[model samples]
Target chain A: MKTNNGSSRAYSITSILILIILAILFLFPLYWILTGALKTPAAINSAVPQWWPQEFTLRNFEVLFSKRSAPLFEIGSLTGPIIPGAIRWLINTVFMAVLAMLLTCITASLAGYALAKKRFAGRVILFSLIVAAMALPKQVILIPLIKEMSALGLYDNLWAVILPTVGWPFGVFLMKQFAESIPGEMLEAARIDGAGELRTFITVVYPMIKPGVGALAIFTFISSWNDYFLQLIMLTSSSNLTISLGIATMQAENSTDYGLIMAGAALAAVPIIIVFLIFQKYFTKGITMGAVKG
Target chain B: MDKTLSPKLRRQENISGYLFLLPSLVFFLAFVVYPMVMCIWTSFTDANMNSNTADHFIFLDNYIELWKDPVFLKALVNTLIIVFVSVPIVCIFSLWVASVIHKMKEGPLSFFRIVFYLPVVTGSVAVTVVWKWMYNNYYGIFNYVLKSTGVIDKNINWLGDSKFALWCIIIILLTTSVGQPIVLYVSALSNVDHSLVEASQVDGATNTQVFWRICWPQIMPTTLYILVITTINSFQCFALIQLLTSGGPNYATETVMYYIYYTAFKLYRFGYGNAMGVILAIFIAILSAVQFRLAKEK
Candidate 1:
């Protein structure tokens, strides 16, 4: 009995220690980011990190907001000055990502409902094609995609990025799984009660699969927001660039402006962070429920 | 009235379904399907961005030369190293953390879960910038801690050195992105049959034995899913490499995706890049098929 008690105590201690270590590991970088954004360039470059800012000021924000300094778009030369360009890029990114999400969720829910509930011709083939599509990397189509977009006069537009990702096969797959868990009887009953397919979807089905849609929305938003490769290839002008492209270009042009870069980064992180916090309950439930089917 | 119009209405329903899916299908076929066909088509040609006015056929020349291209070969090698090394480390760490959280009750455990998952919500720009600061060669937090602790004699150039660059990137990738897998593992563990665990304990099975014998088998499918997705993700890894290093230190960290971007956009070698892209697609598809087959077999 004493041995059992000792072992239990030991187990508890070990668990606590492990948890602390993991927590620190996970949280420290975030702490660093927050502090780095707040600190001055001199303080940041100091041999010993102030741990806290020596003199906190909104100078970085001021630098970001000042538009009279330079045009953000003209810094393509091998060596030239750059404007902050971060704010405009942020607006473009968020707009595209949100629009993409809305389009994806609507289309995905429809396709998912069809795949999960309806019996149709080429059902097996269509489902197989969607699954196979998940494995097809974006690289394979990128070159031709560029040509096609350019031909359509959509190149260097925000729509180019938004449209390509809106038809995400995995998003459809996830929704299909969630829709499958809904009883077929409910749909049948709705049909019997003179409800059209669209009506049933809007009324009974969408509400039931809100968590799945929410999860998909959260993920799609993040990936689209974080996306660099497509945005990089598509957007030529700095003003048209997404936040990710803006930051990358800024880093490339001015490696010395670490303070401004980190500040821009913090700004970029704020919107998504706010979205996550607001939708966290749904996000957590959605992720857990969505994982099994995923 | 119901009987008279039922068949016609059913046909209308089917039509509406197809109509509803039209936008997505059109986009997919045009952007995804058409481009895929074009990629394969271009691979068989000597099509250059500058020489688009002329047609030069080069059947299998790109593939033949790709095997010999040193940079291409190096990128392939680096990609494999990253996928294999990083995925398993991420899985193990996420599982460990998930199990710890599973043992704890809801209050604090839930808080930690949210905290860990915050990185997933935070945009890549923020994560990259944070790591760029943390992994700084001079006066960055990581080096600062290491030097202060006397762990290292001097600051190290993390994203600059060929020796440590990829590994540094991999570490950052694993640490910040453990959130998704942790969520998966937690859900998987929670859904596991508690009765089986109780039965094992009553039969005098130790926690270690139960975990090895029971939980391991149960979570195998989830693990497999993670493996497949992680492999796909590793292949798709671009932003971090692009942001931090730009495939620098003599292209030591160049993954195929990054290489594809460079070749098509920077080098004006669309044909060659498209061919390489097709090859990458085939590799991923074959691997994904194999993974699904293996998972289904069990």
Candidate 2:
């Protein structure tokens, strides 16, 4: 018994040490991006890699901002003052993510509730189609989606990205998992009081599913923000480009300008990373809930 | 759970249900279902970016050409290699990480989870570009660190060489991929039935035996989930290749996803690209079905 206990303790200590090392390895890239963004060009291009910036400078960011310019906001004939293109890209990304989140939450919660609680016709078939679609690669449908967007005169628009993201079935499936737990008795009691369907959903059901909505909201936001492939395909104009796409195009133009590119990367990554850190609990719950019930 | 409803009650339920579903159905049908159907139909026609005339039906022509195209074949093989290698590694790695940290105090557990997840939230372009710097021919920390540690005497152009390029991509892919699985595994592990574990331990089962016999079976569903998601994620690896290598070094890192992008967007061969997309979808569907079958048998 003594020998067994000793061996188990030894095993745990070694494993914990390995986990710490692995955690650092995982974090190194973000660290590199942040530090590389602040490093001087000489340090960036030196033969000896600097683990930390020896001379911190904002020259990279200045150069990035100076590369191009776009209007801050556009409202038909009225446009906001021109700003650095990187800032414009950042604003475009935030708008895209927020709109996608809102749309997905509203649509998915309603559909998910019906699938879980309402005895609707074609429920099984609709739910099955959703599951099947979720399993297939979303990229497979992009070609047709592009042509369809163009036909609707939405091609090269942020909506082309936002609408497809909203249409993804994962959010609906996740809400259904959450909706399944709503007490049937509560819903029945609401109905007994002669409450209409919308009234009951708004007052009772919405409160119950708020946490699930929170999770889905954050999930949709992060995904739409980092959905580089869709953003790359859908938006082509320099002003319409998301920050990720902007940085990618910049990388293509100046492959070896590590400092400037890293600055752009930092700008693109930091906002989403901050959001992820703040709402990580919901994000984690959203991921596990989607998988566990499926 | 079903209870018999009166005729009026059934009608009321149907109306309410369809009302609730209407908003989502509109978007789903317009964006998802329509695009999917059109994707299949377009794969059989001679569609291109510059063609204004109606696309003529050329059934099976694109599919036949895809099978004969060496670039497509190479991309398919590379994609398979990525999926097969990353899925098992990610599963085992996350399982180990989760089992270790699930026993830790709350503060440390969340810290580890957040640390691992940072890469994923960092955005692919940022992550890929940073990695591009690390794999650079000169001034890359990887070469500097390895050389200082006496691991290698000369600088190795990691991404410029075909032999090492795919492996480097896979390594970066694994880092981004494992975060969610670890979260899932940790939750799954904690939810395992402790009663059974105690019973086995009371009967003098060894640690390994308890894990293999009791804990493993209970978490098989989570394992299967991780496997499928990781496989899909690996197969869709595009931004990394596009940013870092652009499927170069002699197409060593070409993947079906990237090739589809190249064909449709770059070459404007919409029909051919849609054909590849169809094949890719079929491949994923078959693999997912096989996984489900294997899991069910177990």
Candidate 3:
């Protein structure tokens, strides 16, 4: 028994040590991006790689910002002041993520509440359809979606990306899981007291599922921000590009400009990384909950 | 629960339910359902960028041609290789990581989870571009590190070479893929009935025996879920191939999903792209179904 305990203890210690080493290796890419962005051009292209920047400069960012320019804000003829195109891309990305999140939460919570609490005709069929749709690859529909967007005069619009993301069924499915935890009797009480459906949802259902909404909100935001393929296909104009798309186009144009590309990469990655770190608890919950019940 | 509802109450329930679902239903129908139906329908016609008037019915010509097309077949094979190689590696790696971390202190556990997940949250474009620089033959850290470590005597054109390009792409795919499974597995592992494990341990069962006989069966669903999701993700790998190789070094890294995009946007073969999309969907469905069946038997 003593030998067994000792051997197992040694085993765990070795495994944990190995995992820590692996973790550092996993983190190296992000580290390289952050440091590489700040390195001098000569330092960046050096044959002998600098583990850390010998000389840090913001010149890469300066070059990135000056490479292209777009208006700060535009609404029809009322254009706002001009800004660096990178900044414009960042703003566009944040707007797209936020809008997608709000729309997803509002629509999903309402539908999920109904699916969980209300006994509707076609409920099973609708739920099954959602599950099936969720199973299929989302990219398969993009070909027709492109045509549909053009037909609706929304081609090359951020709304094209946001709308499809909102339409995904995962949020509704997650909200339904959260809603199932609400007591049926409480809903019954609300109905008996003459509370209308919307009121009950707003007053009772919304509060109960707030955590789920929070999870879904962050999930959708990060996903929308990083959905490069959709953004790549949907938005063509430089001014309309999201950060990921903008960075990609930049990389393509200046393939060997490692410092410039890394700067753009940092611009694309850092804000989303900050968001993930801040709400990581909820983000983790969202992922596990989606899978566990799914 | 529904047996006690009066007809009038049931009717009211239906109305209220539909009203609540109406908002989400509209978006889902318009964006998801409509596009999906159109994709299938367009696959049967010779649609193109200029087919704004009307696409003529071509029936199974697209699929028939796809079968004959060498590039599509190569892409199909590469996609399958990616899926087969990555899924098992992801599943096993995540399972091991989850098991290790699930027993750790709260701070350390979360740290490991976030570390694994960072690559995923770092938008694929950023990840792919950085990797592109790292694989550069002239000035990449990989070559430097490998040389210093005496692992290789010379530089490798990692992305530009046909032999290594697909594997390099797969490695990145694995990093992004493992994060979700780790989260799922950690939760699933923690949720395994500890009392059962304790009981088995007290019965003089070996640790490996207890894990296989007890925990493995219990977490089979999570494994199955991970399998299906990883398979789908691997099959749909697009952004990496697009930004990295553009399916080159002689189409070594071409995937079905990337080929679909190339055909539709670059080649103007909308019908051909849709046909490939249909086949990819069918492959995913069949794989998912098989996983479900296997899990049930176990």
Candidate 4:
């Protein structure tokens, strides 16, 4: 019994050490960004890489809010002239992300319900297509997608950015998985009691799958919020740029302002972190839902 | 309920399902499936951006030319390197962390799981910015740690050097950003038949033996899922690279996605870009098909 206790104690100690290391590894980046955001530009770029800032100032934030500075980065093509407005870009990003999330959730829920509950022709083909689409690297369609966008006169527009991503296969797939678990007996009863399919979806199915929708909302929000390339390509005008584009522009305009750049990055990250915290349970449930269903 | 007795009404109820799916189907066909088909067709044509002349079809010309394009070849090499280096490392590290969480009894272990998963929430832009700072040569935290620990005498240029930049980025890739794998592994572990474990223990099998022999086989499907997703993700990787390096130091870090973006947008070579895009689609399709086949076979 004593030997067994000793073995367990050893195991516990090893586990603790591993946990601490992983924690530090995970937390260090956020801590660095927070600290870097707070530091003066000079302090940030200094040779020693100080653990603590010598002087803390909100200068970076002030600069971001200030109108005196020139545009952060050139609009398009490396050789393009600098366009001085960054505020519009940030606003556009916010609008695009929110809109995309709203659209993705509604469509995914509707389609997912159809796929899960109702038997229809080509259902297997549609489901398989969605699964395949989920696995597809976005790079595969980017070039032609761009051309098509241009032809449709939606190129360099926020709609272009939002439209392509709204039909996400993963979202549909997640909703289907969640919807599948909703007991068919309840739906049948709803039908028997005079609830139409859409009405049943709104009242019964939607509430039952709120957890799944919440998870999908968070996922779509994060993906759209973090998206860089599509926005970079589609939003050719600086005034229409997203946060990612704005940050990229900072590199070109003044790569030397490490503090300023880090500040922008922190700002970009705030919404995602907030959403994740609020939906943490949903997020975890979503993963398990996806894994098992797949 | 008797209202549904009519044949027309029955047809309408069935049609509602299709109606509900209409929006997604339209978008999918327009944005996904159509572009996919067009990409293949465009690859064979001498397609250029903003041209008045119709596309001149030159069968297999683009592919033949692409085979010789040093940049495409280099991009392919860089992408493969990221995949081969990052996937196994992330998998092993994630499994180790998951196993650790599995061993712990709820309190600290749950917190550890959250910590490991924190990166998944922070978004790629934040991750990229933080890593860029860490990878900075002279004053970066990474260099400072290495130098202070006496592991190296001087700072090693991480993102600056062509050879080290890709590898440096790979380390960041391997960090296993969210608690995704851990949760999956936990579920998989739970689903394992406890009797099998008990029998092994009764047979005097070591903990490691029980894990390898019983747990591993049970979770093989999850492992394959992770493998496929990670592989596809590695290929799709661009935001972080674009943010940190911008495919800089002479296109050293350019992946196919970045290449396609630049080719189409920056250079305005839309047709050529489409051609490259088709190549990518085929590559991913084949790879994913192979993955599904392998998983099924097992």
Worst 10 residues of 4 chain B by lDDT: B1-10
Off-target runs (Cα >4 Å) in candidate 1 are A1-5, A67-84, A288-294, B1-13, B51-55, B289-298
Clashing pairs in 1: none
Error of 1 at A173 (Å): 1.1
Interface RMSD of 3: 0.7
Instruction: State model 4's lDDT.
Output: 0.77
Q: Which pairs of residues clash in candidate 2, taking residues 3 or more apart in a chain or in different chains?
A: none
Q: Pick the candidate with the highest lDDT.
A: 3
Ranking by lDDT: 3, 2, 1, 4
Q: Is candidate 2 or 4 superior in DockQ?
A: 2
Which digits, one per residue and each the tens of the lDDT, describe model 2 over residues A148-238? 9999999999999999999999989999999999999999999999999999999999999999999999999999999999999999999
In model 2, which regions exceed 4 Å deviation?
Answer: B1-3
Candidate 4 per-residue lDDT, tens place, B23-55, comes to: 878877788778777888888887777658798
Preferred candidate (lDDT higher): 1 or 3:
3
Model 4 RMSD vs true structure: 4.4
lDDT (Cα, 0-100) at A31 in candidate 3: 95
**Candidate 4, residue B65: lDDT:** 82
Greater DockQ among 1 and 4 belongs to 1
